[model samples]
Target: MIGAVIGDVTGSSYEFDNNTEDYDLDLFREGTTFTDDTVCTIAVADAILHHKSYESALLEWCGRYPGRGYGGRFQMWLTSAVHRPYGSYGNGSAMRVSPVGWAFEDLEITLAEAERTALPTHNHPEGIKGAQVVAEAIYRLWRGEWDKIQELLISSYGVDYERQLPGVGVFDETCQGCVPLSLLILTKSTDFEDSIRSAIHYGGDSDTLAAIVGSMAEAYFGVPDTLAERALSYLPQDMREIYEEFRDRFIPTSSLEV
Candidate 1:
């Protein structure tokens, strides 16, 4: 998705040593490239192309990507070439989750796919829950159900969301900790840049966190025509095509403000 790509590209520079508050399009322009976040998600997308079932899909995805910065348990599965579940709640789920929200037409189907897709790597409750929240939120936001989405986020996650988010640090990458916060990041913004700034302002797990936030934000915010054109110019032909296609696919059917 463009959200993840733009975030990944935009936030790539700050990955090594920077606070979330330091945000700018200049950062994105400075040598951004796709990392494991996009690669593994590509594998996930690849797997889905092969089969509809989660087990089969993940197995295929694992084979294709073969472990690029995968977590402990996932690495084991990749190297061993076997199906396994770690029951983790890592932020990796959130970064790769945009597809689940965009791929299915039905909300329940989207959430179902989210849970199903999550099971192989993050079968734990927190993991599944995190993916479900992101996929579902994007669905509603795309449908112009802003208030419903906002209500669901507050009721399901916690109160003082805006306040709680900035406190969650870069090390707080767990699904239980990061996903709702990621939701808050997407909810708090008015546009693509502001959405990304919200992630940086929150100041934790920033690049990946921002990537997750950035991808979904782009989905709803609908990148500015000029920015999108310039950003596209920076990408390679193949990836640029993929980005453009995904932008259309993930773009919400309705326009709404969060």
Candidate 2:
């Protein structure tokens, strides 16, 4: 979870101006902070930990943190009284679905919860699939099944690993574009930080891309202590508390620590 937050914060500054030329980019820049990605991830974790609906938790958290770079449609949904899904297939579904991967041990249950997280807003089939793919990747990595991930992606999702990534600074918010790129980046990366750099190098929705990749990288490589602490610093006390609680309850102490 902290890994996702780290990626969101680190990539926040680069969301608009991607560092296409610098793989050794600074992890954080001036004024970098958490965004809707971190907030929604926390909401997902809170919903699972406290047995609340995804809609209610998202409303409450999003209400608390307005103007954190939420998508226009999501912002409208946030303020409107009507709380039904708007059938979006944006990468937002995958960006916020990281916690679902950590909360459940069973793959079927993980995919089910991932769908539940997406349905409250991103009800499109691609939206739901994006969420499931990220969660399933993280769950598999968490279970130490990383070796089979490439096969799963190719056989099930038909990800063309050999295809070139999108051009730099080309922002694609849809799940179809972002999820496969994130998975490809993960498959090619050498470590947690390298995966994030790869996402940034490819440009386009940097924060969301890094968030999705970071969640899987954390499960696979484990977040560095320095990076984890830096990410927690950006989160407010309440958000930090929820993260701590979720971390304690869901993640094993041996695998990760903040």
Candidate 3:
């Protein structure tokens, strides 16, 4: 989705440089490439198209992009043929969960699909919890449940985010680091640019953080025309086309719409 893609491009330049107080000038300039966000989104899309099951999509994503810079725990999940949901609670699942919100027709479907997709690899409660929370947030927005978005996101993520994170956090970018923090960025953000920047400004695990924030921004804010266009310019030519196709396929028009 545009959310994850924009986050990938914007945060790509800031991953190794960890200065929350210092924001980069050209960090989101132009021509930034998609990393794990776009790749994993594509893999997930392949699975969704190939099979009706969200679990199928999760497995497909794991296999399609083995070297997608997945966390060590997820890499383990990706490599195994005979695998169970190894119970990884990584933010990787969160970073790539935006599509569930867009693809499904209602809130229940979003939650179920996100959970199903998350559990195959990230069956750990925290992992499934993060995906369910974000997907429900998206579904609420999609269904015009704005009054409930904040309430659900907070309760589900187990954070009382009175305000989006005040500044960058230093702990590992695990669910503890990424989930609530990304929610904070999304909460405070007013638009596509602000949302991605807010997430990137936090520094650690900037890419994943940005990806999560960006997805929510798209789900709620519906993405800006300019921002969406710029996000696409960053991908490789081949990938740009694929990204466009996937977006056109899954986003914009809902499956329930004529």
Where is model 3 more than 4 Å wrong at Cα? 29-31, 52-66, 159-171, 236-242, 253-258
Alpha carbon lDDT at 256, candidate 2: 85
Off by over 4 Å in 2: 159-165
lDDT by residue (104-195, candidate 2, tens digit) is 87999999999999999999998999899889988988889988788767764575644534556789898877887788889899988898
Query: Which lDDT tens digits does candidate 3 get at residues 91-198?
Result: 877777777777777677778888876777778888888887777776666566767866775676556554433345453455655777777667777766787877
- Score candidate 2 by lDDT: 0.87
Name the lDDT of candidate 1.
Answer: 0.66
Pick by TM-score: which candidate is best?
2
* 10 residues in a row with least lDDT, candidate 3: 162-171
The lDDT-based order of candidates, best leading, equals 2, 3, 1
lDDT of 3 at 103: 77
All candidates: TM-score:
0.80, 0.95, 0.83
Per-residue CA lDDT of model 1 for 159-194, tens digit only, reads: 765554436455676876777777777777888878
**How good is model 3 by TM-score?**
0.83
